[model samples]
Target: MQEILRKGLEEMIMKEALKKVLPLVGSVAMLAACGNGGNKANKEAGKTDHNGVAKFNMKVEHEGKPIKGGELRYALVSDDPIKGLFNPALCQDQSDQDVVNFMFDDIFIVDSNNHLTNDGLAKYKVDKDARTVTVTFPKGAKWSDGQPLTVDDYIFTHEFIANKDYPGVRYPSSVGPLVGAEEYHSGKAANISGIEKKDDQTVVLHYKQMNPSIEISGGDLLSYVIPKHVYENIPMNKVMSHDASRKNVVGNGPFKIESLIPGESVTLVANENFYKGRPKVDKITIDVVSSKNIISEMKNGNYDIAGMPADQYDAYKDAANFSVIGKPAYSYSYIGFKLGKWSNEKGANVMDPNAKMNNKKLRQAMAYALDNDQIAKKFYKGTRFSANSLIPPVFKEYNKDTPEYNYNPKKAKKLLDEAGYKDKDGDGFREDPNGKPLVIKYATMAGGQNDQTLALAYVQFWEKIGLKVELTTGRPIEFQAFYDKVEHDDPEIDVYSAAWGTGTDPDPSGLYGEHEKFNMTRYVSDEHTALLKDISSDKSFDEAHRKAAFDKWQNFAHEEAFAIPTLYRTGITAVNKRVKYYDLVSGSEDTKARLYNLQLTQSKPVGE
Candidate 1:
């Protein structure tokens, strides 16, 4: 059972090689960002609903004849600097993903319905009877480095993440379903026995049991392929910072990394050998710009396309130079309470029954005290709205209109009084149930113009309900630092506010499962576990049963109050009129808007 431990003893000595290569945190900082796609057809802007959310057109049509070739100047709207982990397996930060999207393609294409289609680099066939998924890559596919993209590359991607020494957060949920994955990950098996290679371009994944989750990208299947010839010999710990992952990264996507400036910018040239065909543009440059400066930069024609921050939508909405294209994103901002600590040895969350914020009524009260609607209207204008459940409405098939905590100070105070949290010290703030002073430390990321204002407003909301909540570190933390503190369960943080970028699959297990490191709140419950399993279980093949499970989980999570949904975003992009083709509709089946088909009406972005 422990044979795997001995197989990698020599690799332990090579772990220090990463320190010589690059500092771990700095390397991660170089590789974090976001990405979105759009459609080309509806030239008109969308209308705002009563919830203050503007329903933008999913498709847009621009008038212009596409010219031969030019450069695309893209901007990643973020106040945080990019962390350079360019590898698809290691890059999880949305900001870094924005850059990665230009260089890497998914192994299988997922359509608007969140179902996998045979329109990508490879085709797949799932056999429930055999509990195996077979992926076949066509012979012609080649990496940007002119190397063959074989089945071993796909198999290597899973092995890299499942390796015990690998330090990424994707291990538990991403590859756990593969048979022997746990044994390989826990040092019990020499190698994953389930990843079988039939030929150079064919790989079969044998799962312990197949479920409906595998129907989408976020399932046990590897979403992106890595070049095995590049990183097979590198130490697992050093792979993230290796030149192959950063400066000289290679992929089979439409673009190839031409130059990278660490945390600031990246320039990519067309991959002539791209499976989809050579990209229409000569080169593409992605710059990391502060969200506050995005609007102004778009006005000055400094960008061909830029992610427009929700808070700045009003300023850019009517700008003649660019059009505001948007669609509902599979993401939500939420406030989570630390109810337990993660047990690394157990590889599971250990919920503490006596944690300070463990009282259900206290959490409920805090949720009720938040005026998310007001924040949506005041700060985001018509771009975002208060969220009702962890499952964003974009997953229309599963997301239900469940009961939610609206701004109700009266109910909040009532719940607090019933829970025995009162101002026992004669101070306005409430005391714990034991008559002790209660203070909740909150942490939020620093970004955009209204970030601080919104944080202060949340603090004030809790104050109004007699709960004393203060910011951790006395202020909002930087993007990387914020996640570092949250993931590590920093003692100063009792609560935190953050957003989640969901995958094409509607399963929440990756984010909230007991063994998931992405479950920052470290919450666990018997019902929660069972509900999650039911959502992905074989029985979930029945549409009614799956939806009921999702509905039940949302209600249960809401009632538990471990995580309170705050806002659902409208992903808004400002595209210059000179751009001939660009898409904002995520996970669409249309290939015309892909980089390979991108065109420019003019040599440079032009302001109206």
Candidate 2:
């Protein structure tokens, strides 16, 4: 197995190097002045002691004493409201995870080592067949309102989310391995016979086949046990949309929502009667602020934790009071082409009347055009990896053997010329077969400074190949609207940016499989579809088999010209040095940072 893995990795590197021999492709700050007395005061506070080093141990001292309170103030970046506390059903953005991580606990949670362990409410055991799993709740587990939490909560959550009436809420992956779960979720079966209540506190899940991924997915990390008492009375539609439902929903976790101010802030206070001892901090407040203000707020000590994008890391990494940690996120950014528009029914290229991109050779030539390494080094400032595969590197199943498109402008121009795209009218831009200009509009989120910069860089690179590229930017919401309007239902836009962030368990089914709703590029092949199916259903949990399957899929995607991967983001967290008990854990899929192991220092003030 070790040899196989090593060989696979070598193949990956070789393929990446063979793709392109691309063309060849910053700042200081003032020191703060301090008086002798002020320096003495800072030394006394323990703030300046840990400067210039990254601390791995989770211990801290403040003012020559151990601080006890563990209060944290975070900032929200968007206004999407969280609709549910249930994990499989939770679909809100980053802020929702922020609130849910504290308000509710999972059945089996991943520790710092990425190993799954029983936490919160249940102890689980798997039968020899690996098909039947049993769970028992801790005797004293109870909701915030003091009602006993039982097996029924878990069963109800499984049933509710599987119901077709919920539409978008169905998490078939979480329950599909169980007997009758797929049928029930797809509306072909009335109920899931596999879920049985063994007793008051015990539940059993029976599956038709052996599946470890299902077991991982069934655990609390993805499955949040819902409150049966609150849900039983609310109408299904109202359950998600009703204000009363959101206000009164009860959960079993360390904290409870004290107040929520919509787009501004959310406050949570530790639940004194929490089954587990109350969290050390009295409260956690998350305030909404724009990305531009995040660093300034952190510098002034208005916030204790903030997330800085990769491009901004160098500007803030030198701060004496801050620590920066970077890890691979579940997200990757890529450029997708409009295939439907390329093959117009009227047989005319809608965007470029010459239809230069309609030729697969031309598209492949464009794919190998830009130098990804140069982009990563020059634009990303070494904060991100040059992604060659659709699967981000964070996943164990990611195909490291996949070939990468190297940056070679000369090769790109040669391919274009061979494919018959030429400046026929001597206008300095290539033309399609129909004698129309080969100009394309690249769409991106309008106001994001980093995205805009990246788009501009791409435009410059594509123009070198005699391609006329135009830039179109929209607000985040408007950009999504334009994407759906043009790329999905129609094919007016030539290229656009899209990203996918997987959960802890990396499954590409929703994004790459046949009939995938999110496969916006509409690139499909039998080989790619078969590989995705094999990976999804393979039962041995063999890492090599999965990697090989994905490797083939990546090769197919590259040959078919589905999308051009730009960068795989490295998750970054910027926190004040005084904050203690925070550790970065590996494994799992959700990108929101985990705080289960976090605790405040014993001697610091609430904000200090």
Candidate 3:
């Protein structure tokens, strides 16, 4: 162990030496590939190659042994002030999603590698020809309130999302293949005709079209299985605000809500009657801590498990009894250009003719002007690498040769000139195509000091090429309001800075599709729709065919430049040596950080 630690230390020292001795281009190359940060308590490990791409071994660690009855305290990062109630169906942010996972089962268990398994349902089977999935539940399965989890619960879930008056959208996409879900949500039907309750224990879901995503899509179904008994009495539209969602929430998962204090903390105790058997941990306490304070909290022992900020990896990566786990995060973050007006209450973007950002070449020029290598080194501290496309390099479908905008201010200036946006006036900044002074509104979530610094870095990059930008929100906007502006498409928000963690499969449709609520840019085209459909919902059985389709779409999207893919990063979490049986992942679901199976102990069998 001592020898391994020495070698790791030597690597970091050499990396730093290489950076100073090398020129600007060579320094960026060294930063990308020089860390052993993403290992499981150093039991087994991962490696980064010359180009800075991280390769994860993903060997399962710390399991099959548990010391029961201990509270695991965790920390979270939120841009919002954190006062909203928890509703699984309506959850809009990471904090809500993390806590909601304990209050509800994710319906299916997705592993670190995107391999999904049946968790909430007793039996799950699919028929490709029928484009249908049949689901069943065990008789012993009961809600936290002791109500039997029946077909009515599942059916009600579909109905709830389909209810037009219900706030916070999560469906129609999950139910994309469901025969009548869109019709019901659009108020064209009374009920979802595709959902069939064969008996109290069995249900069959009929797909309106071909869908290869039925296996992992069970989570959407799981979101709907709210205790029908607990919610039946309440109005559908008002259910999201009910105490059943937060204060008095009841779930059939391994944990039960013990106490609730919004924005402060939440404590959950193990459920003895959990159908999968009670979890090893007796309790789990989630504390809402500022991202800036997470590193301090971890060092002070206030955070037993916390997302390790990249800038602080060196402080704890080789610390005694601590493991900094890293892996290809399942998500991507970007700077989105508002090509259309988010003109409706449902967060629809109506493409506007008069919109200044309708010029694709200008958006492309901004993409070209970014100093991504600097951000990766200074902002990410070698944990994240620059991304050319929204498709994460972690996925099999990611096309490495996709068109790139690799930090060329010269090319950016040329593009701006070619696009007819030149500095006709004596002022340093360029003007609109019609020669009017141009000021772009750049919106971002309100965050701590680090966030402010990062935002400035972005502004400086655009300013270099004569582009003028102003911060959209006066101050750091709270989390909920920030998304409300982005999603609902406030006209004031032209180019917004944001990040999205991708999901299990390398499917981008859910974010870029015409109907997706999370499509903040509101980017859509007939070609984009057809390509997305071919990958997931209306996909072909041929793997090669789907790969080609994905590759085509990624290249096209890159050229279009609706959003600039900023960084594809690996999430690092500092787990105290005492905390075992957990890992960090990114993507469609929160599988990497599964807390239920987590145990607190010092000893474990071989190969754990």
Candidate 4:
């Protein structure tokens, strides 16, 4: 009778496991069917939307409408002050780019749906080889100062970022595919040979090979064109050192920088001569505040919009005069391992040689140990989802066929024992062959309360398996410095928590490609590298072969256990409902704070 009971219990547990896995499979299947149907419908209609350009005969009624001016006060959480007005090439982390996006425009703009949309910018085409791309500036487009927008501006930005003398502010991933970008940035080449001005309004780019979809989209959204006539004579080294030049930067956008008070706020006024037409709102003000102060300001009506973290949602969800907008953000949290830094000069690994963590099997086992669903529920209040793959489910190419590691503590212990870590000393803790406890340092940033709480929970989770973990936190700037060291492969840490904002393109090359400077894990394999290269160089966007290649890449990343994906959180925004005359764009769903299509309602007072 006892044997029979044990068998019955085992059967029940197996059924429970199947129930858990079935939902994830069903969700994926439904998503795939929807995506395939959309594609088929578009193809059958003989036309499709490219980026944000729609095929339907929809009219833009507000294009020639009268402009209504008003002041928009935004609440922002910013650490570093605005250091320069240049594109991220001068100071990447400073909140200045937010101001720049309002003041100046890029050659190609990305709409809320992650599609390339033409603003004042014009037509772009790629050659059959995919090596050369040409961009043409729209006629009548003018800078804020009324100077004609020209191709020379795009050429200047390309050359400026590729210049060795300039500050290393651009993401290396942005310039990785340009033909001469690496050599120029490395100081090996005199100048970039990839960028050339074909005429007064045309600029051409040459790449080493065809780039992945993400790289192309990033190039479009990130490469903000600068005024050549204004900054051509300025020395590159002194670019960030001059306040007058940085404060009064010129651009071809709907607004221009009016004033920036250090550590306080930045104020902007609409550009009367904006090429697309003047913006409806008259002024925009962004006030920097601490995370602790964001809620109070929002409640008091001192701020129009605030990006509240997931943990704070419950506290403010039922608040009067406020509505929480939730949408999937490309950002995801993960735990990375320092793979190449395991060995020391004595030919001994500083970590336990017999630790299952040293083997990929052990790492995958740990991933299986954690109950991601429980973490999402108890910690995030069910506002997030467990992420099993590097790419989020929103992307079409994400592979659902790959097996996900389910929560199974017994399986984790079994794998650990198989890899030689055992409780031989009978001390109730697993130990290596040398009798040392299996300990790891888990480093996280102390920038906010959420990070602290999450770190504490992770520590507790590891402790349950007889693993000793030390949690360390540091200031945001100091933490970023430590992260940079890990990216360069000089890891002083064993494990660390990080968040990656996946770009509009869902490709994993930036995180998994062998040559990627952002691959913090130092994890590389020949198979992975080849697949990344193939995807990056594939230009046939609608080809079945390209889709298959991308699917393969996603599948490989899921099986490798390169990193432990924690959760995918939605970007939440709280906005005053009184403000009207704005249409939410698809990609802008993360935050309702975008100024692109915003307008002041005629019924409301300007200062209300």
Candidate 5:
């Protein structure tokens, strides 16, 4: 639960959004064969050779018996300071979410395969016949502040999110299936009729229908509940800025926040009142480490654990003192084309049939112009793979039969030629069908030098196919500014490159739905809408039917090319040999529970 919840509830689209901060590092390092400490983590070794890819171990099996009561130092990689929005409901940045995970735990248990079970803090029973799920919180669970975890706290979370004055990015769509969530969100209903509290420990959720995604942690079926006693009186809009949301935040997880220097670092100690037994480690300290210095810092034994950036994996792959763990990340980077604008009045996307990028052939041609395969091999050293579909490979069941987009410059030129984009002005670049200059304004986020190089490489790929793709403001925009322009449907951006940490659930509707703000492309169509419905409809309860719908959407989305999948990444973490009993294989659900058994073999990490 800590893994997925560490990022957020499923389907909150982000700018690849620091989905752990390991993906943003730049600079190249030397490569070596999969080494001892790293290879021992996996039962089967990953193939490795010059110009070939090697897979790291998924878990660290350190030697020696564990000793108790040692501090675990963690590195938070980022270029900017964390915003310290500790509340999950209001926090949008994944970097901040990583910090909050130590003190918070999701209600559902996510298994190794990312499926949610009812074995965590809260237990629930889904009544298909009645279209409801009744949740029961064990009476003994208490927040760090010693307040009892109750049904009122659970209900207050939903009420706060649904309040008309709430100022967070989490939409009430997860609860839209509820009886009166729409009315509550629109300020029509005083309370959600679907969320009924039967007792102090139980709340019954009345839904219009049930879908398979509910078991996969979708639709916010079971999530962490904030202490109602602490946050009930705060104005909904001002909740994030209030003291309770920041320095005074409270949660029912295994750890409690001790102190924090906003945007710098945080110190945490074991939570004696945690529903689970106390954590084995005495204390934990997490510090914000710039991506530029993290690898060197790790070499100097300044940290016990840190996420390894894919581009820098080669440099750190041979570290003798640390074991590297790798896994298929629940995220992907994408290039989205602008085809329409979001309509607040209609509460849906309004397609611009005449939009510059609305042409299917044009979109396809642009997608073909991207040599993502070469980019992955050259820039990411095969740690990142060219994405074939929006539903990443992490979702094996649904990702299997999707369309593939490979590099084909000739095919790209042919598509453009057929679309009537020709160089009538005798310039190297092609002109639009209307014979006007075809200058595509591209918006992308700024990052390290290698990031700039990768961005420019994409532009060069477009240039080779005779498309004029220029950065939005002469260069990649800063993170916040880039999203601001894209979210507002800035006309200057015809296309943009960004990423999404596709949470634990495999549903893409939240990111692509007509009414979703995360649908930055603003594309809307009956065929697309129907396919999305098919994937999440009541009929999707049949696994085969749901998978088939997913396949159809993948094919349809690929053909539409409104948002072209760019790269599916591999997430790797380096842990000091001194740290014992740590594994990334367990999905987010097992994050906190693992800490209870975690120990240190030595007081100081290796290389100290």
Candidate 6:
């Protein structure tokens, strides 16, 4: 079995290398700088831990003491919210992920000090030379349904994702070169030889080689244990629409979904069977609120706590009844073009002949025209700052060679002119090399005025350099439809403005890798693939080698003008005075300010 696994890995690595030669593409804790002043709000910089990465914190205070049964209402800031498929295998977007967290627990959770801790895991050991991980579940671990969550459930999560018929996108870059992964994903093998269910409570995973990423990015932290009894019979193609996934999925987390209203809202109840003591709150409801309407809703007391918009911060910061808080979040806002096409059958990421964004010089010109600094100041107040790379400067491995695209209209015009884009037809906008009107189609989400506000700024900047622009402004689609078009390679979209709230792990290949479904940017290149592989799943365990590989990939992607990095965000969450225990402030990773930790204050009057 071990030998078969070894052979499978060897074959996959060869194929991976050959492909590289081708071309193509919030958690926290609380520390406070609280209350309000226009100047005080801007200085709400994230506290840093020992590692130098910015720390995301959670802080809330209520005069009344904690009590259980009240419902915490959160007005979600998106047009279209989650669309079923609540299972870990298919929940891709932030809207779905926000709710998924209540049910599923990751293998590791970064602690206050920026180190990985086995939050849900009982015992985990890594054998560097053997390239293996052995995990044991707590003997009495129970699911929401009161069944033991054993080793089979964990192993089956890997098997399901490795199944070629399964249509989820996270496994490719998230878990690198697992033993037998290629054969398993290709259906050449019935099972992955690297995984072994040693007993009812324990499981073992074998990798092609050892890398530091396994501590966080490997299937360990990424796996969502599935009940084999419930899922084994479901067809892979129908899994997204399966009843179990949409409505009845089970997990070992502290809370469980009592009801989900597709795009409207999600209702959760404390999981009595949870290994952690039942959550302090008895019920929590997340209701969808359009970005344009969240302010009104907050004023009407329709929302207990939600993200406060930058424009509205001044109104709430000094408001005695509101807790306006900001902490640096490990996230980036950017714009990307669709650069390649995906073929499901061939599994090939190749250049699209009809791709509208094929010109690298044009992309660079636009990048040069972007004034991230100006936009950050005007739109974000003090909540955000200019970012030069997709990888924010907060990370230790952030490359110093990252190209900064500071605003330069002259440079933009020069590049556009050199690239043969000229006003041949006597119009203000330039024309392509073939004399076709050069127009960029910018697609963005519709729920918030902020999207349009930011889009307008982008349009003005590009038009200053003589580029014609058409914005997706007439009708706004909900988050679900917006992402569907973006990820499915909607031909109408030339560029899309997007943001990513990253994980504790530094590697971001899940968003940039060719095989990753989340690689919405559609960038494809042999050089990129090679560099990603080296830094993420290096052949050697040497620290210096990995750092060099990381810098190389960072600089290569930036120099190629793959995407325009906008800014790093400061998270803003405002809670009414009555809302208590807004969060426990744990890991500085991706999370909604925990409503599970919330309790209503008995002493405070409604809307106080």
Off by over 4 Å in 2: 1-66, 77-88, 128-130, 167-170, 215-222, 233-236, 244-249, 338-363, 417-426, 431-439, 447-451, 472-494, 586-597, 602-608
lDDT of 3 by residue, 379-425 (tens): 44467789888888877889998987898989999999999999888
Of the candidates shown, which would achieve the greatest TM-score relative to the real structure? 1
Q: Candidate 5: where are CA atoms >4 Å away? A: 1-39, 42-46, 49-53, 587-593
lDDT of 2 at 385: 59
lDDT (Cα, tens digit) per residue for candidate 5, span 1-608: 12322222121112234453211100000000011243376332244546465565667667877787889888877666777888767776677777666777777766777566766788888888788889998877788988788889989988887787777656645666678888998879899999999999999999876767776654547466778898888877678789888888888777788999998998989998888788888898989887667778888888888776676666777777777777677778888999999876676788998899989898898888887776666556667778889887878645655766788889999999999999999889999999999999988877554445556667877888899989889887777677779888999999988887777677787788887767889988899999988887888888888888898899899988889998887777777888765667565454532655667889988873
Candidate 2 RMSD to the real structure: 10.6
Quantify all predictions' global Cα lDDT against the true fold. Answer: 0.75, 0.55, 0.64, 0.55, 0.74, 0.64
lDDT of 4 by residue, 1-608 (tens): 22332232122111000101111001111000000011122121112233211121111111123336777676655332334453434543324444555676545645555555543266677774656777788667787888887777777767776665665434345555677887887778876777777888887778776664632445322345677777778888777765534677677777787887865777888888776577767887877765556667777777655555554545666445444444455556777776653221321123334333457765766677666666554444445667777777666766667566667778777877777778777876778645677666666654443444445555656656656667643322234454455544453466776766665576677655555445656567778788877776655354576678788876776667768876675555555443442222333232222344465433232222
Model 4 deviation from the true structure expressed as Cα RMSD, one decimal place: 10.5
How many collisions per candidate? 28, 17, 15, 2, 5, 16
C-alpha TM-scores of all predictions = 0.91, 0.77, 0.86, 0.77, 0.91, 0.85
Candidate 2 lDDT over 1-608, as tens digits, reads 22332332222111010001100000000000000021122222212112221222121222222256567676543323323332325332333454555666666655444445565357777783556778787777788788888888888878876675653323444555678876886679878889888898888888776543544432222346777777767676665565534545467777777887764676888876576577666787877655556667777777666556444555665555655544455567777776543232331222333333446667767777776665555444455557888777776767777777787778888888887788999988889756777777766543233334445556767877888888653322343354456434344466776655555555565555444334556555567667767766544357677667667777777777767777776555555555553334432332122343344443332332
Taking every candidate in turn, the Cα RMSD to the unseen true structure, in Å, is 9.6, 10.6, 8.3, 10.5, 6.8, 10.5
Per-residue lDDT for 1-608 in model 1, tens only?
01222232111111000101111111111111112223332243546766546767644445678788799898876676778888877875767666777788776766756567788889999999899999998997899989888788888888898988887878866578999999999999988998888998888899987778787756666768888898889998788778888889988788988888889999999998888888788998999887667778899999987766665555667787776676677677889999888888998888888888888999999999987776666556667788889998988544557887898999999999999998987889888988888989999877544355556767877888888899999887877888888888888999988877676567888889899888888889888999999988888888898888889888888899899998887767677877765565434466766667778888889875
Compare candidates 1 and 2 on TM-score and give the better one: 1
Q: Compared with the true structure, what per-residue lDDT tens digits does model 6 show for residues 1-608? A: 22322332122111000100101111211211111122232233333344332333346555666565777676655545446557766666555555666677654545454555565455677888787888888787788889877888877887887788777765554343678888888889888888877888777778876667666532234445667777889998888888888888787666788887777888888899876567776877878775556666776667676665554444555555555555565567777887876668666556675677788888889888887775555444455677877776667777757878888889999998999999998879999988997778888665543344545556777888899878764444445566678778787788877777665456767668777666777778888887877875655257788778778877887788767777776667766667654543445342323334456765332453
Candidate 2 structure, TM-score to reference: 0.77
